[model samples]
Target: MLSKIRKNLRAFSFPLWIVAASFIGTIFLVWGKGSVSGPSGNEVATVNGEGITLTEFNREYQNTVTSLKKKLGDNFRKFVKEDDIKKITLNRLITRKLLLQLAEEEGLKVSDWAVAKYIEEIPAFQENGKFSLELYKKFLESRRMTPQTFEDMVREDLLIQKVLTAVNRAPSVSQFEIKELYRKVFGKRNFKYKLFLSKDFKPQVSQKEIEEFYKNNREIFKKGERESYYVLKFPKTKEGEERARKAYKLAKEGKFKELMEMKPQPLKDKELIEKVKEKGFSFRSQENGLELAFKLKEEQYKSLNEVRGEIERALREQKALEMAKKEAETFKGELNEETGKVDVSELVKKLKLLPTTNPEELLNAKVGKKLILPVEGGFAVLVPTTEPEVNEFEEDKLKRLKEFVLNVKRDSDYQNLLNLLRQKATIKVNQSLFRSVQ
Candidate 1:
């Protein structure tokens, strides 16, 4: 869990889109004559003349990498192109710069102390439910962060959150809409579902059905190839990191105080921290560093490499379990006898899987793979169903469908707004810089 939460960011994170706001304008960037100049010549643009320096850009880019590593996991660095991450990061920064500038224009002022307080409140930097000076110091030491740098991140997070909250001031749905949503989302139906295993139909499936299904649902069938993944993680809450750094410092300074007096951080999980310590894993003042945990001959603490093999084994076992569940109610259908042995067209229509010209009965399909088979059960290969057959669109379902359509329209409108922002802003990217990074 610590590994997962620390610095993880995936492709699904904030997309490069502009949010609609009655508010407009960028924040006035506070950089003197010696402002950080962005790598690109075109540094000052929309907001209060904030210069995007190479240093600042690099910082953002590194942050992007850190976040992606957190989300996609440690392996993300190997799989994701650094250039791609930079472009995405740069665009996001610019959009944010514009939004923040607008927020400034609207007279939104966040205090430095507020930022500090917010940072103090973060649970990750806490130990024993209180903000620890040791925790803060350790984080700065390990990640090479200064109090100012940490404060800036907190401020920016709060600033963006404030801006977004303001934009969505009237967060609401109508009573009728809420009722309809509740019914559609939470309501359970008693309608019986019949299984039509595609394997049974596979015997009679023809080339025509195969070709047609392939033509229609080919996109779904095509899978993106996997890439090598690389990940680097910053230890959780600086506790583990602090433990390492303190020992390293002591080793260098020759300060040996096992019962070192240190206060915990605000909002930290004290109970959990105590539990970890109770497990014969007390922080050794100047011991063998992280080696203390890994070097133990007993099973209490396994080396990271040792733990990974077990993790992989567990994953494989989980996959086996899922495959078993999917095969139990499987069905297959086909059109061997044309006239009416089974109405080839009707069977295809009922099953909803697009029929291919030729069908192969796949007994086992891994979760990642999509398969079309006609077995003795019931389902036959046909066009993937968008909605139930003409006879099957139930009463409440129609209403739900209408709402879904509206939501799609709203999403489309949001995208259009983002495109407009992109146009209005002067965004210049240092592609060469990014290319090298990638």
Candidate 2:
């Protein structure tokens, strides 16, 4: 009899459908707290005088976490914390209560048979590609819920869906809106341009000027406190260690580079430093010249000579951008619309050329006007050579746009309804409850 009862219980287990509505429906279920109590024992919150027990809150919280974990994988922790999850879970519970209360007020009903039919249609509760009563019962049994309890949940879920469906009906998209949207997304323009890069117009800087700039921006040359080391590696064998000792002697004689010639390998400084930290190597060991020459941690600012090349490059880029802007302004009016295309190629040879076949940035720009477009190193002088070409009307694209517009409208209305419900509902949460959960 016990085995038969277990089988029956296992057959009625709840699946994904039980929690699907909760996550999607409760996305924007944010609410403010109020002070109220109802002989509080395990109640985490209350919505419209209806108690949301800690048990229900925890169950829903776990379900939501599990779903998010599946969707976000390892990044789940990055986006959500325990406290945030708890708050959201409570909000969802409050929203669920509000919606259920609304359903009750409006006399929304879902028959037991209807709930049963919904369960039967679920693929997870099926066996051998067909719905099985035994499988359904077993599923419910595993969750420690009776068939009646699971059916009740399904009934509530169905009612919520009914309420949402009534509000979420798709709106019709006008032809004008679709056409406008199509134009915005699919518009393309051809640009003829000559780019002037910083490297091409690099201004010559004297040593005195570089020193003056460095003096003015001394803080930019400040280096972090660091420990410099002279690193050397040898094989683990006795002969290798003996050779390393010899090499250490050579290093003392300032032949560090010649010593490094014994083994030619690319030593990535950062990785080597990390490995040293992990292994807890001491300076006293002097193993394989690893601790042969080490400097005390000290703050050292970079000299003008060390960063002279970098500063020059920055100054040149600044000058180049300034010069390019002037050149583009001067060149803009010289070429007329008819001759612009022919002049572009000759101008490109003189400056850095950036010819975009269909430039999205200039989609709405006039064909004859020259634009000073910023590039990575400098700027470009561009003219839209061709008007944006709109493709022939596509039925599939129009249909998709209509559906997209409908969904957007539905979402907005649904959110507004939720906000209105919150105004009408009285919600109180126990702030202390979240501390224990974490």
Candidate 3:
């Protein structure tokens, strides 16, 4: 759980001290029993000679999965993969180890009194706005943790927090930078634009053009070899293997009804196309499970006649885009500079001309200047109708902008520090053991 919270703590936008204050109670639960250990063959990785055990990795990984499930709910699987979570968990562990090592080298120390004071401030261990020993003990007992163990984790977190604070001290912004940032944030400019879209300039495409395009870009029409298969995927364990063998026997005996009753998934495994011949089955081992694949469909590509309409439509769009660009270029050359306006009322009646604001370009463009810019799906001719101006001075707004600039600088510094540490450190990972971890 501390690993998960530390992941959030890395965001320098939020003050590290504030995060530590709020999450002090939950941080101790990260390594309940496996907080301390010696070197072992079960190590997943080592950072600067310090080994990260498998027990620590599994605990952190489970915590991350549980946290994400709660936050994302049913959409969890769509956004995150198990393998990615594992990799992230491992990286967090490595980074945490590095930060702690750096803290030690810098002579950072969290006294017992400091830990006690920090614990007293946590709301979870307080009753009626005061520290309660009874509540603290009860909290630890409920989680099956000793006071010493919890205090140790709190101290480590404090040390890391100190290192982060020292590295991310607020940077000083110059007066010129402040004025420039204020202008960029509050400045606005008025402009008039006329857009030319391919759909509006419909061009006729001949049959010969379609055939010629298809001939030149045959690979674009080529499709990947697809296969339909019935997969019986099970855990890579003894019992799972036994069930797979029985299912394979039923499949060979043509008892598809029984196989279907066993809940074999009717899926497509494109990667197994060449390995599994038609009307034959193959046993394959995956990272998380073993599968029996029964091939169903053969590989084939679509004929030219089947894609003729698609090719024709593509050619028409291409010709239309070319004509639209040509027309826009002509209008750009013949535009009236003094008036700096084009009648787009008729085009607006036909299609939406969404306004796009680019602050940098708007600030740079002089009054009455004309610019031909490329927009989504077309080109646009723009004329600056008004000059850019900054907002009126406000003390509160200026303070907030200064804080924002400092936060950005701190975030950059933190990342650079981590990158430098990684380059100078010797890190080794046990790939085979890591992959074999369930």
Candidate 4:
């Protein structure tokens, strides 16, 4: 219950710090920066005249990495490229700076009293439904934040909210539109269908067609370029790196392992092969840094015979899909117009309708009509059994629907506002400085 309240408070553009002995109550405080320094040192970007320092950029970058790591697990770094992450993080920082600049220009101010009130209202910061000064101090200490620093962050967040709220007005919805929407969404749909598996109609692809496909898409058969290196693992410490560098220097003399008090291990052929197949894995080991002296190998493409099977499979799927469409066309005239129905159980495999497979197309279908739509590994032929009927509405559902629509409008407006500010602001980004962010 306390967590629920804490989450709600955090959504109000204010950070609430709560102190417990364990790592239970936590607050994600938005860090605020001072006035931008001149373009002399490592400034990754500048919004208007305010420069984003390397220190600030690194902090945000690390925070982004942590969040992504949590969300994607081990695949975070694997799927997302370093340069891509840097670009996204830099854009976000610039957008934030632009928003803050706009807030100041619009004369939006947040008082210390408001900030204090917001903090006190957080259930996590309260004891017996009242604010606790001791808990506040402990929380600040735990986060290594001074009271003034926390207050300044809260002030900036509130100012940004003020600017956003000023332009974000709730959209009005009419009764007729609401009723129509409710009918479209909550209406009962009864559809009977016959699913056709693509694999069942696998067309025999000729050898000549396979050759053509392989010729046109030659890059698919080409192997990824690889680098083979004997990695000498060492602990990440000052002494360890020094020793590893000495070993690297001795590599020229062919006494690399002898000098380093180690045996030369053979480069794992199987491991290198696996790395070539999987694009996600990085073979370079940064800890020892000995992999730098190794040789790089050019990639070799597979022979035509090696990739013939793959091309044949792709061709078969293409032909099968075309055949499925033709098969669906044949069933079109089977419908009896006067009765508005046909018993297709004997002719085709009958199945129930599922929302996952083209719900919109199936729901809005005309009676006694056939819709041949693509499904996973197959095609489905749908026939609506009955006309769509509106379900009874509830007051709570109507209220929620209105709020959802209004929120969508406000979100769109916010994005447009950001784009306008980005175009108008004198923003400059130094690509070289991005490399220095640790």
Candidate 5:
């Protein structure tokens, strides 16, 4: 009977499903106060008396904040409101706590060496394919993370994850489920489009809406958010020579470094050297010796104003992302926020991304020149240029837009599902650990 019970439990375990969702749903949290007094001495939250530590929570919290900011940047606070961050953090921590508790109930386990080995392989802390002590120290200093703290966090994370894997074994998903999952996950149609340009859509816009849109976003469409005039080479714009001369003079004078310091760097990034270098490495004008010079963090661009186009472009790209999201909503054929369900095949058919070919090109498909893609909450178009546009954002933008909108609805849906399941769960939490959180 014991063997039968174990076998039956195995039947219910769906390791693939759990593992797929495990890291995909990476933790997002805020710093929790206190530390683990000893290895697993106290629990932050528990399910059936299991311990989740403050240290683990803090580590994940920092990562969550870092990951979110990387993704949303200036807008992270806007989308992930303070209350939402805390709520998500608490919920994430609690869920992990419960999962670990379940793992313990089943006696799932991992070795310290497994975690140690994994740590050694992390590229961020590595130098030339090996862990570098210097890189490790610099990283911790930059994030205010310490070695002991980082190790405990990684260990707990690995142990919990390993335990979850043990509890949820393979072959539990079953062939029937896999077949169904296959369609749900991969059922998509490709779109082929003959772009209806802005002009085409322009006439359809109501006078009132157009005027209203213009009024609210007049600033958005303003030419040259950067006040600098373009240098129209061959017959450049007025002041074009002056602008070029100014940049050339700055480079010649070797004052590029001083000039760089005078410009505004984002307040949040001032303390972050690597991140600042990342932002400033790319320049506006064509590459020359100046590009090589700026490669040294101590070296700067020709002049701040000379690279005003870069600044303006960066800022414009930021605004465009938000605008793209807003426009995706209400786009026809979209998985609207309301329904949250899309017959993706239908979309593929509509978008003409289906496998069917256009015979006119004779064994070659006539790739649409310009096509506006409507996402769950944004609209985007790909316009082919003579040259590849800087930061094509071709793949990343579409993926992000989908994650932004589809996930909005998907998140709520999943949470509601969890709520229903939680009612049936026998779980407990360490209230003292979280009650004082800001």
Candidate 6:
């Protein structure tokens, strides 16, 4: 159950909040706070007068934290802050409330039998892959939740799912639409292109320019202090600890060759470099009784002379690219489409014209149209030589394309529906309570 919650939380995205809500289901059922006395007190937020209680918000926040902690381990704080997590949790709750209210307004109903079946199908309440009444009772009892409350939560979940499914139904696809999409995906065109290669253009670089570049971009030339260290890691056993101690003693005495015989690898952890700044021996312990030892090396950097050749090459490439773009633009300006006097075929032969496979630009380009398009290594002046032709249709490929188009339409429709609902609904949030969330 924890693993399932973690997986859903990790995969949660704001646009697909409805899908995440479906996975969350009645997990919050156990966290139910008994009847709200007033809208302003315990309720964290209200969706069209429906209160999302503080207890519910807290539980959701804790569940989100648990899921993230399990997934990210010790590095969880590095990725997300507490304030961000709180905002995500509250927004999710508000969205869920909005959808559920929308479901009620749309008259979406969930039957008692449907709710019962959903609860029965839950693996947590099952024994030996079959629904067990005894396990179900015990599970609810352990969570301090009654069967009535749990079943009601399940019914609400079912209604939300049903309404989302109804709203996101795939729209009808016309034959013309499919054919156009088919052409777009599988069409091919013959195009002639003259690529301006930067390597072919040699731009003169002066010694003064190289020196100025080196001075201006000193940070790029500057290398960080790097220290290499050998790590001797051993398992959690008694024998492992003894071996680690022996390895550490040898490492301190500069017996690296003897340490190499013990199979210690080079330590590459950046954190260790910060901890052990000086050249000496360092020891650490890891999970499950694992022991480790490190022997550090003095940090060093290279002189400017060592990287002068690299800097010169970079400057030359920069100037060459600029030259290539200008030359391509100049050639593009020379061609006259109306007069047809440019003899493109003769120029193609003389300049070694390359074939363009950029389908998007090619599809949009009409015959006799010339485009100055950017290409790898430089720019290219492209002209479509032939009209686009749809390739032979394969059933599998067309089916995939149809599905892709349908999904895009559905996603757009779903977002539009959510926007309309949000615009109509009166959502009131308790800012004080939300700020109090830790």
Q: RMSD of each candidate?
A: 21.9, 13.3, 12.8, 13.1, 19.3, 14.2
TM-score-best of 2 and 5: 2
Q: lDDT of model 1 at residue 73?
A: 96
In model 3, the Cα lDDT at residue 114 comes to 81
**How does candidate 4 score on lDDT?**
0.61
Instruction: Locate the minimum summed-lDDT window of 10 residues in model 4.
Output: 20-29
Tens digit of per-residue lDDT, candidate 2, span 55-125: 78777888778877998896797987766777677777777787777667656677767787788888889
TM-score rank order: 6, 2, 3, 4, 1, 5
Q: List the pairs of residues colliding in candidate 6.
A: none
Between candidates 5 and 6, the one scoring higher on TM-score is 6
List, residue by residue over 1-438, the lDDT tens digit for candidate 5.
Answer: 223223544444332112333433423432233332212335556444445567656665665677679889968988787655655665676566555554565555556776677777778989888899898889889878788877766765665555434333321233444333333333322333232222222122234544454455445443332211111121144464455455545545654554444342322323333443454332234333121122223322244434345444444454555555444433444221221122344444444432442222211222334444543223443322222112222445445444544445444544443443345454454555555444
**Candidate 6, 130: how far from true, in Å?**
0.7
111: Cα error in model 5, Å: 2.0
Q: Supply every candidate's count of residue pairs whose N, Cα or C atoms clash at under 3 angstroms.
A: 71, 15, 0, 0, 14, 0
Model 5: per-residue Cα lDDT at residue 412: 51
RMSD of 1: 21.9
Off by over 4 Å in 5: 1-20, 23-46, 50-58, 137-149, 164-436
Off by over 4 Å in 1: 1-49, 181-420
* lDDT, candidate 3, 332-382, per-residue tens: 454433322222332222234445635456456677776665556677676
Q: Among all windows of ten consecutive residues in candidate 3, which has the lowest summed lDDT?
A: 21-30
lDDT by residue (91-194, candidate 1, tens digit) is 66666675566445545556776766766776778988998888888888987778888777566655554545443321234645644444333332221123
What is the TM-score of each predicted model, taking all chains together?
Answer: 0.42, 0.61, 0.60, 0.57, 0.37, 0.66
Best by TM-score: 6
A best-first ranking of the candidates according to their lDDT comes to: 3, 6, 2, 4, 5, 1
lDDT of model 5, residue 44: 57
In candidate 5 the C-alpha lDDT for residue 2 amounts to 26
- TM-score comparison, 1 vs 2, better candidate: 2
